[model samples]
Target: MPNPLAAVAAVMIAVSVAARALIAHRGYLAYDDFPILSMADRNDPTPDYLFRLFNNHFMPGGHLLSWLALRFGGFGYGPFLALLVAGQAAVSVAFYRLLRLMLPATWTLLVPLTVFLFTPLTLEAGTWWAVGVNVLPMQLAMVLAVGAQVKYVRTRRPLHLVTLGLSILLGLLFFEKAILAVALVFLVTACLYGDGLWSTIRRWWPSWLVLTGVSLAFLGLYSALATSSVRRPSSVAEVLTFIGQAISHTLLPGLIGGPWAWFPAGDGAPIASPPPAARWTAIVITAAFVAYTIWRRRTTASRAWLLLVFYLALVLGLLGATRMGSVYSAVAGSVPRYIADVAVVAALAIGVALCGIQEREEKAAKIRMSPILLTGLAALLLSSAFTGIRYGDEWAKKAGRDYLANARADLATLPAGTVFMDQPVPEGVVGPLSAPYNRQSEFFAPLPEGPVFVTQGRDIRVFDQAGHVVKGWIDGPANRPGPRQGCGYRITGGPVRIPLTASTAEYWHVIRIAYLSDRDASATVRLGDGEPRGFDVHRGLNAMFVVVYGGGAEVVLESGDPAAGICTDEVAVGDLVPAPAN
Candidate 1:
């Protein structure tokens, strides 16, 4: 007869993958996905481009995969989605392997694996391309490394040591935080397999030394290249608030299939939005489970739970120090991606506590029926599935899909030689913080056969709110008519200054020159004592906009070419905008 437990486990794994595949299908590239793909498309496959830190993350492996996906896959969504699904499946299988090694064959073995597979807590890491690329591999490595450590402790094999070191390196290539995987292995060995902590270190010093060397080498490279400024909690109160939000609100409920409510997270994916009742119920249930496990006598349950708490503290500490100042800090814990690896570790901990690691001499026992436990497991699975489906639907409705589709279609239709005036994407796509990446040039780089983009152009257009190409103009608080009544300001070989009717403020602003030239001229324009910028004045009447720094009382224009001359009548200092309709 077929083993019922094996059949059940297989079904759960299938359901989990199918559920995530649905989410990936419904999802579109969002936020950082734009920048990741843009960077990949813009640069060639050089060590410098591949290994360089992106927004503070040193993820050469993820970048390499992205570059490969772009090279072979083009701009289609298929390659990225396939990579996400494959990575997720690898992590699930690696985790199941770890469970098999750590626990005996019993119905109890399936519970933690089930939770790890279905928890809505990992939805973001599983579905989002940019996040999944880094996070999924790290998760896979953590499980594999832990399992490798278990094998080494039992067999003391040199092969297992190499595998363990390779696993850590694999994670580091994808995410800086994977350094924590080494720490987890230490926790597992010292707490679970050791007769005493000191003895374990004495016996395992060589393995520890190797892991440390690998981590230090990676950190050395990371410190030199990472460009993001460190964000630290500003106050004790802020730290405490982050802890409460991450632990009490996010982590606890997440473990028990919760944050039962889903709300759209501004322009990004939906975040956990559990009501008060959901939060408290999660707390009661999870707390009771942990307490009962620890209170059970003669088992290594306390030690296993201790390992979990230590790892949780480590994760919390890292997040509290770095992410406490986030714009979404209030809901930082509710964000699934940050704590995705925690679910993997928690599963390992659950298995260790329930079924001690000691090998059983008896044949694998059949799963004993327990009415209460079975019902609770069923409820958890059902709750998680509902939440996952709802989150996927929310993801499908996001604006990124429509925006990318419309922009890509329209860009292909633009006339040849129509250069775009660079600007940040519509605020709905991403915020100002994304910078050079959020620039129209970078944002649209992945669109196959897109038009060229330049900072300043005489024949330039702009993407309007709906991403359609349109005539570009500059609108500013200060629009200065030429000081002269007629003929405006003329340029020969020397500088010509036109005083402004209103003073421009001290900030980055665009200046537009409306001019007519009998001949093309190479010229320089300067704002009050700021650095001079070069521009071209074409024959006949035309307008050009250039970004300038510092405030000024006038516009200064000059031609380097003695033979070339131009006339300008107006200057506008502020932002670039779509030209107003006649």
Candidate 2:
């Protein structure tokens, strides 16, 4: 029969996948997801193109995985999610194998493995394709590298050493932060089977040297070619602050709780720091935990210490590389995706700690203790899993809604050959045009063929080939009324007709204009070829409305009295919508 542990591992993987199923049908978020989708839809993703793409960034392995998924899966959310779930499953299996190598064959190991598999911290990484593409592969590589180190220690096989080196290299390519894999292996070896610090270094120097060389080469390539726009830390104070926040975030949630509020589903606001009281409490608890571990250093096995050290190293390594910039807030470093690896490390540490204590107790006397601690841990794990699933569902709903709204807006407003520019919208609003790194050619790459050019920066403005402002266009005004108080242009000539494009015709079936007249007058408004509709214009701000269908229209604002024609301020349009009240 197959190993019983395999069955447990399968269950954990299934549960993890099931928790994130809410996002299976969701569309891409307004980020690198669209660019990856664009590249994947290419008819010829040639080696040259792929090389250029990877060389432009630090994550070649991650981009390679995304390319394969998009090329084969055809940009469907389900297929991309399946790839991510598969990566998560692979990581789970690797962790199980690594645990089996360290811990005795007992059901107790399941506790830590379950926690590792089900933590809420995994939701963003598992559900978001852009994040998962980097995180999942790096995690799998890290775990496999650690397992290879364990095997090499036992069998002293050259193949295992080669496997370890290759795994580390692969992990580094996937994410620059994967350099922690070597550090983790060294810590585990020292904790579990070190004779002396010098002796350990002497024995492992060859493997260390190989991995170090690989890491240095990878760093050099990344530094030379990296096009990251993120700002790096300028001072030692910023570095310490970033690292401290990362460590506190990693520990507090798994041990004491409260980071759940940081999830996107909760409050929809980013948290800068934990409460002062909670921070103090965490500091005290951490100090006490460290003191206890030191007091029992000789009696306790190094497995627990290994787990603790690895946990710290993982947090510091990942966060230090990514969150070193002063632009990053404390809460930014605490995001669930960034801390998932830390959560897994914490869970393993807890398991190893329990195992160490139990072993020491059994050596003194044979006794069975109450399962209260185990029961509490189980409860925490279940609660966290449920919370994670709920949060995933909420986040998926928001992302899907926002994406659909943005696509609809794009389709309605942007005409073929239109050069689109983005202006920042308020948070929570639909804004695909305002997404980061949006290129002029890839605006609608995932959709049907279109002549749309989208560029980043500034608001929409129309200009002719001669660089002169194109007049009478809704977005580009030819003339400005001098000394006006309100918004929009003040009409001085005969009846001014503002032309609308095809996109505007489709987007807005109704047009509403806010205006003001110096004298009592009636202004006529015509949409498309429809008959003119007249509205009484008051001296103060007034409103005029019209409805249109199919092709573009012209808004004719002709004043009954030409002495004070019209001073129009704001013109808004929407599809068959009621006009806003003055």
Candidate 3:
């Protein structure tokens, strides 16, 4: 006969998957998602591209996954969302298996399993495709490795040991931080199974030696390949603050179905900002539970809690030391992905505290659920589900989704070969820091068809922040007036130098030329001492814009062939803006 608790657990996992799928389906690609997709679209399946580090993360597996999704899935969110849900489901199932190995099969088992499945704490990692791709694999690997460790401890099986190694390796494939999984496995084995630290070491020395060597080798490879430098906190107070906020403001409240409040984070998913009342309530509830468990289980509970504390310290310490220097460090802990991996570990610790470690041939205790336990479980589930759903709704409605949709629809209607000048995407799409990916051409590359883009063009169009195409023209305060009206600086021979009223700014500036050419020819424009930019001149009268770096008080223009001359009537240096519709 099937165990009723097992059936309940399966149903809960199913519900969790369903909820995740619904939320992820509603969410569109945002923030870092674009960079991954853009990179995948631009690069071929070469070793250099595949093994490239992203923001210091050596995630070849993640890169490969992104590439596959872009190739097979096109621009739709379905493939990525499907993968996201599937990975989350795998994590839930794997965690259940791990829980069974660590704790007795009873009503008590349902508590931790439900908490792990329903916690709003992991909503960010679950719904954000960019974060999910890396986080879920690491989470899955942690649970599998821990389960294998438990099995190895009980049976001393070579197969389990092998699985343990492979699981850790699998995590390292996706996230460099998975190296922490080794320490997690060691902590579980030593604290839960061994009588003393030395005894555990003696018994598991061989396993420890092999795993340590593997970790060290990977660390060396990661260090060599990753380009980002390690960041350190400026002061001791910064480190202390990170720890306090992470525990007090984020994790503690999160464990108890908080923070209940949500706020938009620009184009990214919503961030947590529970009210003070909610925070205090979460703290009190969590503290009460901790005190009760310690009083009831004495040393057994204390050891389990100690394991949790040590693991959190290691993970948080790593983040505080390395990430505090980041611009977003003040609110880093408030965002969930950095610590999302802790959900499963928390469940494991809770299970051990409630049910004790599983013994060989031990049968699950038949414990009845009390009224208070039932009430608490129901409240946590409802509150967490509500908060997670609210967050998902915000993610679904982010402005980036509308921007991309509008841009794609408008792009599809444009004439083929319509030339557009390249520019940085609006801050709503991606920040300037994203660089190559933040450029309009790169951001739009995932679309099947779009207008051609160039550095400079005649009659060029540009997409406004709303994704509408508009005529572009250059404007500036400084202009090198032509010698006479209706006739700009005429470039007939060698180099025609037109002196400006004042020197231009020292940064990049766009130069616009309204000129008449007797015949088609090549021309070059130089600003100050900067290198000359080459452009094509067409017959008849027209205007063109070209980008040049640096600035000078004089403008220089020259025709490639003296016989094929071009006459410029107007020359102005400045930024490109949408021309007013007449």
What lDDT score belongs to each candidate, Candidate 1 first?
0.80, 0.57, 0.81
* Model 2 poorest 10 in a row by lDDT: 464-473
Query: Which pairs of residues have clashing backbones in candidate 1?
Result: none
TM-score to native of every candidate shown: 0.90, 0.67, 0.95
Q: Model 3: per-residue lDDT, tens digit, 1-582?
A: 998888989999999989988887787888788988889998997889977887778788888889998898887888888888889889999998888877777788888888888887788777888888888999998999888888888788788888888999999988888898999999988888878999989997766876888898998888789766669777787777778777767787788787777878887877678888887888899889878777766666778888888899888988886788878777776877788888767878887877777672144333346788889899988898888878877888766677777777777787777788788778877887788788888888888786688778888887777777878877675555677656666688888887777788778888888889889988999888888999999999888888888776977888997898577767878778778779
Candidate that scores best on lDDT = 3
Candidate order (lDDT): 3, 1, 2
lDDT of 1 by residue, 1-582 (tens): 998877877777877888898887887777888888889998988999989888788889999999999888776778988898889888887887788787777787888888899888889887888889989999988998998898988888899999999999999989999999999999999888887889989998878988989988988888788765558767788788777777666677777777777878855777777888888888888878777666652247778888889999999888887787767677776687888889888888877766656563133232333686688789888888788878887888756667777777777887778787678888777667878888877887877677687767776687787777778877765445555566677777788877777777777777888888888767888777777788877888888878777687777788888787677777777788888999
Clashing pairs in 3: 488-568, 488-569
Clashing pairs in 2: 417-451
For residues 163-206, write the lDDT of model 2, one tens digit per residue.
98899887776666676767777776666555667887887776
* Candidate 2 residue-wise lDDT at 360: 39
What TM-score quantifies how close candidate 2 is to the native fold?
A: 0.67
Q: Poorest 10 consecutive residues of model 1 by lDDT?
A: 360-369
